[model samples]
Structure formats: structure tokens, C-alpha cells
Target: MPYRHAWLFIVTLICATIFAFWRTYFSILPEAAIGFHIHGLTASLWLLLLLAQSWTPHHGRIGMHRALGRVTFVAVPLFAAGSMAVIHSMAGGTVGGDPFYALWGARLGFIDTLALGALLYAAGMALRHRRNVRLHAGYMLSTALPLISPVFGRVFNRTIPGLIIHGPQDFPVFGLGAQCGNVLAAMIALWLWRRDPRFGRPWAVALGVIAAQIVGFETLAHSAGWNALFLTVGTQPLPVLMAFGALAGVVAVWLGWRLPEARGRPKQDA
Candidate 1:
């Protein structure tokens, strides 16, 4: 609750969203622009909801948290879908679009997959730690951070081209905003984990996935002929999406089964 920077982060995201709208700051076409805006707004709303729940006194969490959590579960995947659409539409149409596509198109897919994992983890943690007051709250809070991909996508939204961006031409070398977010999340998650080591494991799991995407995206993007391979890989029909969704759902439940039940607490805080 003493995290002033966290409060500031939500505020910063709000302002960035405003600028992104007012000045057409993201340098995208109308359709892609709409997709980004919608996703960004939903992502911001989700984060605000998280902040609201987090700052609320425990006694105050009677039902709002549960309602908000349910809404977030439905909301994030839609955002992920919109992001996928935006990425697909922009593959070679705009400046830096192709390169960024080549560099990180699979990233949206991978992180979207991570969202499913986080959602699964959130569901289990929500139940397993329901009785252990402190651990449940902290773990659930961190788990939610990664559930919505905007934090990563949005980070790169403002960060990639820098403040003085002139169209999308200069997205070369990518950007560090997404990494900044992961590091911040890891640090805070670790700080909270010091209060209980169980928190450390999931934090590590989520953080590890985030770090992996950074390497994974660039690696695939840079590999010769990977662009063509991914382009073909990405050309899935609705049946494919549905099948993968079903398979992913099964995998999520399986992971939910594997997490240890919340049973203990740290003896001291870091």
C-alpha cells in the first residue's frame, strides 16, 4: 500500500492513453488504431480495477473484488484478440510495422498464452489462499498483473519509438518499456515475497515467462526465413483458434492442479 510508484504508474498510463488518442501518438492506421485504442482502454480499465482492489481495505473487499476479477477474466482475452488483429493488419503496411511484426508478432501470441497461464494461476491462487489472508491477497494481486498483456504491449506502445517519434519509421532496435515493466513487477513481487516465500515461486514463474518472451520474440524474428515460417504459422482459421483455445483451456486446468495448496507463511518480512 505504500507503493507510491505504483499509484503513479496508473496515472502515467492514463495520461499516455490520453496522448495516444489526442495526438494520434501511436502512428497507426484507422482500423489498427481503433484496435489499439480499444485494447489500451480496456487494459487501463483493468489496471485501474486492480489498483482499486489492491488499495481497498480488506474489510472493503466484500464483493467488488470478486466481481471485478470475473470481469477482468473476460476482458483480457478480448484485448488479446484485438491485439492479435491489430498485429495481423499491420504486418507490412506501416513504417516499422513489418520489422516490428517480424520481430514480435509471435510475442502477442506467446504473451497471450502467458495470459492463459496467469489466469489459470489466478484461479487456483484465488481458491488455495482464500483462507490464508495475507498470502492470498498478495499472490492474487501479482498474478493479476501479468494476466492482462497491455502492461507489456502498452509499455512498448509509448516506449518503442520514444517521445520524438516521427511516424513508425524508427522502431528499429525495439524498446525497453516491456522489460522495464517485467523488472518492476519482479522487484515488487519479490519484495512482497519476502513477506512469504510462496509468493516467490509464482512471481518467478510469471517473471520467467515475461523474460522468455523478450528473448523468444527477438530470437524468432531474427532467425533467417522465420518471418515466412511464422506468417504461415499465423494464418490459422477460426477452427484452429477454437481448437487451440480448447487445448489451452485444458492445459490451464492441468496447471491449476499442479500448484501446491497455500499452506504456510513467511516467518518474517524482507
Candidate 2:
């Protein structure tokens, strides 16, 4: 798709994120923690980067776009790091002091990090194939679907509280919201795949990841082994979190550099 068409998705994402976090992020005296601010700012930077990259290419500034693309190697990891920080902070206290709540938060955070890592890996891989710009764009854009799940999940909890099943002890509002997000993402992926089967690969990969994430979240929510793992990770020091972020960053960069440069021949079918 052309930048003009793609720009709509970018705008929609920006608007949705802002609206979702309006009370916490956009307030005059926002009471959110430092970690949230870091996460929010970094996430916003990524979206802005996407917007700029899209805008430049349409304006006949391919050089500028490529330059901005280089910065992604640095920005992508920071985005990942900030995300982990937010998750850790939330898991630490936001869910209350109960051990089960803490375990649930850790589980959610771990799965979220995995999802983000998978999408980043896919996006980086897509970039290596310049010929399949549609596929690349599909991978890049699909990352937002999961990223925004929490926002919509919280919204659903407050607005349509009883539509979904709640967990035995605590309300599983976020999980329901994420499930709704997964379904929406799957629908979008299917629609795009049907539009051009040639562009289906990335969408297919993204859908697969989303499916696995949902399955893992559901199956392991009550597993003793998984909770133990989450507890270990959740109790780790700041250095460990930083190390995990750094390792994920390295993997993303390695993936970006793994494949040879594309021949630049645009696929005729897609």
C-alpha cells in the first residue's frame, strides 16, 4: 500500500493510544510512575518515527526515510526496554499485594515481552526484504495491535464489564480485552491476506504469534511451573531486567542483519 493509505493506520494508532491513556498520561499533573512515563514516551517516539518515515517517502524524500530507518536499530531496543520497565513496575504493585495477583502480573508481563520481541523480530526480518514492501508494512503495522491491547482491555472493563467471563478470584478484564484484541488482529490479518496472498506471509506470521500468545496466556495462567518462573523473573533485580532488554535488542539487531539485501525488484503480484 502507498504511504497515503498507510498513514491512516498511523494516525489511528496515535489517536487510540492518546485516548486510552488520557487520564493517566495526558493529565495536567499526571500521577503515573517514572517507568510508565518512560514506556509511554518511547512508544510515542516509535510511532512518530513511523509517521515521519511514511511522510518522507511520499514527499520524494527517500533519502530521509532511509536515514530514519537506521535509527530504528537504536530505537527498537529502547522501546523494548521501556516496555519491560513498565511491566515490571505494574507487576510489582498495580495488581495489589496478593501473591496470586503478583503472579498473574508477572505472567502477563512475560507474555507481553515475548509478543513484543516476536513482532520486532518479524518487523526486522521484513525490512531485509525491500522487494516485499507490503509484507514489510504489514509486519510493521501489526505490532500496534498487541501494543494497544491493554488500553482497549481497560476500556472494556469499565464500559462493558459483564460481556466476558471473569476469573474466580479477580476480574480478568485485561485478559478479555487482550482476547478481543487478538480477534481483531486476526480479522485484520485475514482481510489483508485475502486482499493479496503474496502479502500474506507476514500477516500469517503475526497471526501465528498472536495465537500462541493467547494460548500460552490461557493455559499457563494456572500452572504452578509457570507461576514459579514468573515469580523468579518478577523478583529479579534491575540489572537483570536491563540485561533481558539488552539481550532482546541484540537479537532484534541480529535478525535485521541476518538476511542479504533484497534485489529491490518489487513483486508484481503484490
Global local distance difference test of model 1: 0.51
Which candidate number has the best lDDT? 2
Model 2, position 175: C-alpha lDDT score: 65
Q: Name the TM-score of candidate 2.
A: 0.82
After TM-score superposition, what is the CA distance of residue 189 in candidate 1 from its true location, in Å? 3.8
Compared with the true structure, all predictions reach lDDT values of 0.51, 0.66
Let me know the TM-score candidate 1 reaches against the reference structure. 0.62
lDDT of 2 at 79: 78
Cα-lDDT of candidate 2: 0.66
lDDT of 1 by residue, 143-239 (tens): 5555323454454555554633345575443345554555565565556556556545555555666566557555654564755544554554533
**Root-mean-square deviation per candidate:** 5.5, 3.7
**How many steric overlaps does candidate 2 have?**
0
With a 3 Å backbone cut-off (N, CA, C), the pairs that clash in candidate 1 are none
Name the weakest run of 10 consecutive residues (lDDT summed) in model 1.
87-96
Task: Give the per-residue lDDT digits (tens) of candidate 2, residues 83-109.
Answer: 777766666553447543554575576
The RMSD (Cα, Å) of candidate 1 is 5.5
